[model samples]
Target: MVVQQYRDGGGARAVRALAVAGVIAVTAGCFGGEGESGASDGSGRSVAADRPLDLLGRAADVLVEAGGAETRTSMETAAGGTRVTIRGQGAYDFRRQMGRLKVVLPEDAAGADGHRPITELLAPGALYMKNRGAGVPDDKWVRIDTTALKDGNLLTGGVTDPMAAAELLRGAADVTYAGKSELAGVTVHHYRGVADLGRAARAASPQSRGALSAAAKGFSKDAVPFDAYLDEDGRLRKVRHRFTFSSEGPEVSVVSTLLLYGFGLPVTVTLPDEDAIYTGEIRQG
Candidate 1:
């Protein structure tokens, strides 16, 4: 993939303002779904030694080992801010392959989807990319001011794994099984993820330096996402989610479509109050 560098989205935005931005909210502990908060109601929860917990643990292991993109919907929700959503298609091969991602916003959406296609392939530092099919992308791919794309939180590669997702939420959220519910025709088990703003930030601290452990504990958790995962047949299927941001408006409660298991490729997105989010063929090099 050849990335033409045009500095408009600033650090990342300017590098490739080719798509609507993503703001990530990563919180603490464990893997999969959100952690329940508040004192226990005493009705009993998934005991650590129970079959459900064991099954969940096995499922979590499957997710980590499988390590392929299972489709993803990244959303941003800020207090009194506009809401923006970006769904990535194609499996995410963090260390090997370049992932193809698409960007979109709800029609007349609270926040505008900067009509751009992120033809950018993920690398280490440079956020350079190309919109291979920019001129004729799908309808949800609306264009917005380049400034709205400012923020690296939208990059899900660093800590989007299930372990990291669960760790961020479990650190402060109480863990429990919400029984079972039917969603999109799948028998789903829900985990309540109470936003532990602080814990999430701590878990997001980049790999600690050999001697910089001192600074690690003080790292900010303000950037971690508060989201939940919906599982089907013991596999992490969709994200029951919303984010914690300042300028991205409204809490969007939605179910995401995941494909290819752990690779980060999301073929479709089901928004709670809007149309489905999807992308056409992404000729990603």
Candidate 2:
């Protein structure tokens, strides 16, 4: 929410870099190959090769075919000299382009309840938010029109479409295999690379003008490094990115991690009662 205020000039650039960096992390993958044109299995079908773009392309295809998945993200950063940790778990339906995510708010900013967790349910036309824990009146849900919000506002941009992860597959360079590793019990091939943010921004869908792309454009033109992992089938399993933003202000280091699993899993999404939804202006949490 604090990031929404920074829409132009210096601050906006910072937001863009941070947002785009996250996108690159979510979209990278693992494989073994040397060329950029295509990296395929011996059978000739793409199987998430080592080349950055090739691997991501294959992983995106696998995710698309899976229909739906659950994602967990862990973020660590320092803001105004204070360290923060935010954790989120949610499910997305690729077919409907909808998702629901619940995040455990950081303790540093926790209100009376010590940790007021927030949950969001996203649909094409509207957004819903529920703050749980303490001091909530009647526990009513706040509703906001998806069209009214500024592009890349964290609340709206963060979870609009689960399938939007595919957009991260763009603008990869300096790709190479990092090695082998195990994540959550599955064997995976690891790969690392840098993102060409400008290229990625240009390739982004019109609706993708959100925080990540904008911030990415604000950073140095040099490609930012990122890492990703994939299973034997080319399904992206994990990813991580770390960088420091130091252009216009104090240097802030960001470490972001994304874990994708439970592919094709059915998830039920429950919309709040209309009577309990507030259509009026809602303040940022």
Candidate 3:
């Protein structure tokens, strides 16, 4: 698939901002307050002390076992001194490594509303985006190879792939139990740690390894700080990751958050036909 180029202009700037800003965000007021500490039971404490890494490493597996779930994602970052937020709602089939998301970008500089939401299809190694708004045809979908992206589609996709986010836990290190918390009325164990991208790539499943490997080399640092909340069943309910992107200018900070619920939900995602994909060059903005 050919990468869509952007033509220079206000529209192009908005598109570029979406691409760069999609890669990172800060989580502020995205979740409920952290409940009081020391709320875990004896068993929970034992598990936390004995094998936090082991438990965290299996987050993806737990999701897979649960079949599918609904997802909500938030990406927030600052651009040109103004804060931008991108929100997404979707559903994922963990067993098939397929999902669909409706991603809404922030208003443009002029504060104009009514920008169409982008539809994103998530597959094992590819990302399909429609309504991308870089001069591409309305019916054409832009296909991107996740493994080819520097950030491994994590940051580039606006919202991090939920499964990829879980697989990242495979590299959890220096993990510490941060007490207990309530997320949407469910009690969960809160854990904080830094994940090594290289290690995560090696430990991730075949479907996620390549993209994670790309991200390991793409980011300024391989160690990603995170906070994770898991339910009693060891399933991840919510996770927040902090990432930094650096270029010729100052480093850009990003915080990406994913929340999962309604396990066992039916999720169906169909990839577009080859003819439906946009193969033409997208002019740079």
Give me the candidate number with maximum lDDT.
Answer: 3
Error of 3 at 30 (Å): 39
Stretches of candidate 2 exceeding 4 Å from the true structure: 1-50, 124-127, 132-138, 143-166, 201-224, 243-248, 271-275, 280-285
The superposed Cα distance between candidate 3 and the true structure at residue 1, in angstroms, equals 9.8
Better of 2 and 3 by lDDT: 3
| TM-score for each candidate, following the candidate numbering | 0.45, 0.68, 0.84
Question: What's model 3's TM-score?
Answer: 0.84
lDDT of 1 by residue, 123-224 (tens): 222222233233332333222111112222223321122233333342334445556665556655655444343444344324211111221232223333
lDDT of 3: 0.76
Give the per-residue lDDT digits (tens) of candidate 2, residues 159-206.
323343444545567777766668888877777877665565566545
lDDT (Cα, tens digit) per residue for candidate 3, span 142-203 = 77778877678777778899989999999999999887668899878888999999999999
lDDT, ranked from best to worst: 3, 2, 1
lDDT of 1 at 112: 38
> Considering TM-score, where higher is better, how would the candidates rank from best to worst?
3, 2, 1
